[model samples]
Target: MSSLSTEHKLPEIIIPEDYNYLAFFISLNCNLKCHYCINLNDKNSARKDMAKHHMDGSDWAKAINRLNIGRDDLPVTLQGGEPTLHKDFYRIVNETDDSIKLDLLTNMAFDPEVFIRNVPVKKFTREAKYAAIRVSYHPGYNDIDELIKKTLRMADAGFYVGIYSVLVPENKEHIDDVMARCKGLGIDFRVKEYLGFDGEKWHGEYKYMDAISQHERKSCLCKTTELIAGPTGHVFRCHSDLYANRTPIGHILDPDFRIEQIFRPCDWYGFCNPCDIKVKTNRFQIFGHTSVEIKDIHELN
Candidate 1:
């Protein structure tokens, strides 16, 4: 079927009533594994087994290509365990239409020369104030000095690069030290509030703690403004669905697929992923947007 005809046949993906940002997981395959990674929040081995497989680079590029993100808001975000790890990373980046504003989440572990040789500055940048290239700083796996150097090199190459480190309980002081060092070196460094459990306890900044605890469930209406694509073409409602290997709502390649902005019922309210359940601000920096919602949950045993 022709692209235009397919689009016409497909239900127009209605952006949620107050949709703001779209986050696409180019691949869940990351090189550096943080101990406190939220992806492991749902420890159900059975659920993890059900996760979707990775999609091909061409298909990924094609799927992302169909998105209709408007100006200033930025287009789909290309992220993963490490998007650069994908065999067709460069191709996907270069293949995407020029109109879409691209953002990257990386570990900055790739060869800068390769990045500089093939990708232009405009490919991964926008007029937005925040740096486009968000490099995660895992103190355990990455060297801060090297991170600073690499980011500086990217900055020098005209890439809007920055560093983001999760504030894990054990590494707060080290993180502070790294922040000071990066600041002195003129590299963009920021911290993400840690999310998930670490054996003895739970940590994060959410009021609806039990909503995600899984020990108890409270149903509430949930909707998402972000577009989450697993390694495969399967699109998920929120991080929980993606990480828990829940079935996807639709695939970009399928002509029948279109985004729905409605609050769909989710039975696994207790299994919410921190990324989705967390009450964080939206793209416009407005607070109070929960990706998933439950209408009627039982608190009884």
Candidate 2:
């Protein structure tokens, strides 16, 4: 991975207003293996671990700092199976320029003392609809009391933190209980609509129902507002490509790599990831937004 030259620099790539999110999937190696992880994607086996192929913190910073996010409201979200699992997680957080606002998605499984010492309070603080550090609470894998303690610890340290759980059908009652407990403890708890199949029927609201049909394969012109960066600095067109380890649209560290805000032709319409096609809330918590805008669903034959 190479960095751009300071003397002959390419024009700064500005994040468009329509671009809802920028995700840096630092690593996919999670400490807790939840059964209903979306990364599985109906696959019979687990995807190959790419932790060894990840880019260095400095390299990540060099590439990410090039982006011109002109909005005060939008922040680049750092997430993964567990972003804290990355060895250079702190370094990457520290190295990113102060101009870039960061939001973290973690399971709160990491040592809070180490994180508090390394990451500045201001780095995660901003005027937003939700907390900066959003921790996921997986029922069986994560203990509610422990998560609350950790979140409160971070919050007491002057860092904004919150807890979110998926409303899986089986865990619906449990999630509600957890949310009530969190609210009682003064924690900003939120719930996300689960987005996968449940044996008989598929869950979630999607812009294109056929995108995840698993039966139909069609060619379409697709465009994404969100920039999805994988562990090894590879920028993917969609979440499916990122998780499947398919060919990326570009590499972040590559000086030649630049974000194109226009639509590109795609042939994997029906095989799309649930996250990409799922109709969900935006940064402002407004509903009726999908990550990718797909059109021209044509038959392969």
Candidate 3:
């Protein structure tokens, strides 16, 4: 498949307090198949991956245009199984306005030469807690030396990039070993807490662990604190869309769609995906954000 580059120059401005942070998964297809792929987990638990579909690049670009975000705040985060794997990857990034402040989450498997020759480093950066481009180091799927070389090359090209590794049980020792090597190379390699099972018991920090086990039938009103989209343009209220492949709250291209930051009714409390209902912090470095909030949903009409 040929890659597409979308180009649009946007003006610089401050982020508005009301603009919601946006995250878009341009494609669900990934180059490296990790054993602990969160998406693949959907196939067994939520039935999401078994019947997943993806939107074209043009559709994604149009979906992004409908969003009203600010330059200083969160621009649309373009991530995926591997975003560069998208046929129109570059086009989607370039076509967006300059004010959008593009951020990319990838495995850095693409040709840096193509990235340098085409994409400007300045396009993906802003004054934020993390770098613009966040790359992942999967011992299961990535070679440390090559990953380091690509990262350093990008940094040399003047891109604000960082590396994060998941602390999978089998790979914990390797992760630490890699972090030591990367630290010496002057690369920022951070370890993220793993949140899935290893065929024994589930892991990670969760507010209500019981909700995920399918232990019993309980009902409550829920609400989302973030914007999450599936491989397709469908926007779901929680990680359940990622796992269950349920109907989306709305499509990213819908102009009338907006975020409602409060609890509402939900009957699927028993099937909650950990990513959504888990307690976490937002862009502002503040805590108390849950992807979905529940309130007296059992009593709903």
lDDT by residue for model 1 (202-278), tens:
77767457776767655556667677777666678887777766868877677667877677766677778887767
Tell me the lDDT of model 2 at 31: 86
RMSD of model 2 against the true structure: 2.1
The reply for model 2, stretches above 4 Å from the true place, is 1-11, 41-46
TM-score of each: 0.87, 0.94, 0.85
- Candidate 3 overall Cα lDDT vs. reference? 0.71
lDDT of 2 by residue, 1-301 (tens): 3343434444566788789999999887788878888875435332465554677677767666888999878888989878888888888888888988999999987989889999999889899889989999888988888989888899899998989988889999888888888889899999988988878999999989989998888999899999999888889999988887776888876666778888888878898999998988899999998999988889985
lDDT of each: 0.73, 0.84, 0.71
Which is the winner by lDDT between candidate 2 and candidate 3? 2
CA RMSD of all predictions:
3.5, 2.1, 4.6
Off by over 4 Å in 1: 1-17, 41-52, 217-221, 299-301
Candidate 3 local lDDT, 52-97, one digit each (tens):
4667766676666655564466767888778888878888877766
Best candidate, TM-score-wise? 2
Error of 1 at 83 (Å): 1.1
Collision count for each candidate, in order: 7, 0, 15
Q: After superposition, how far is residue 1 of candidate 3 from its true place, in Å?
A: 16
The local lDDT score (0 to 100) that residue 130 gets in candidate 1 is 68
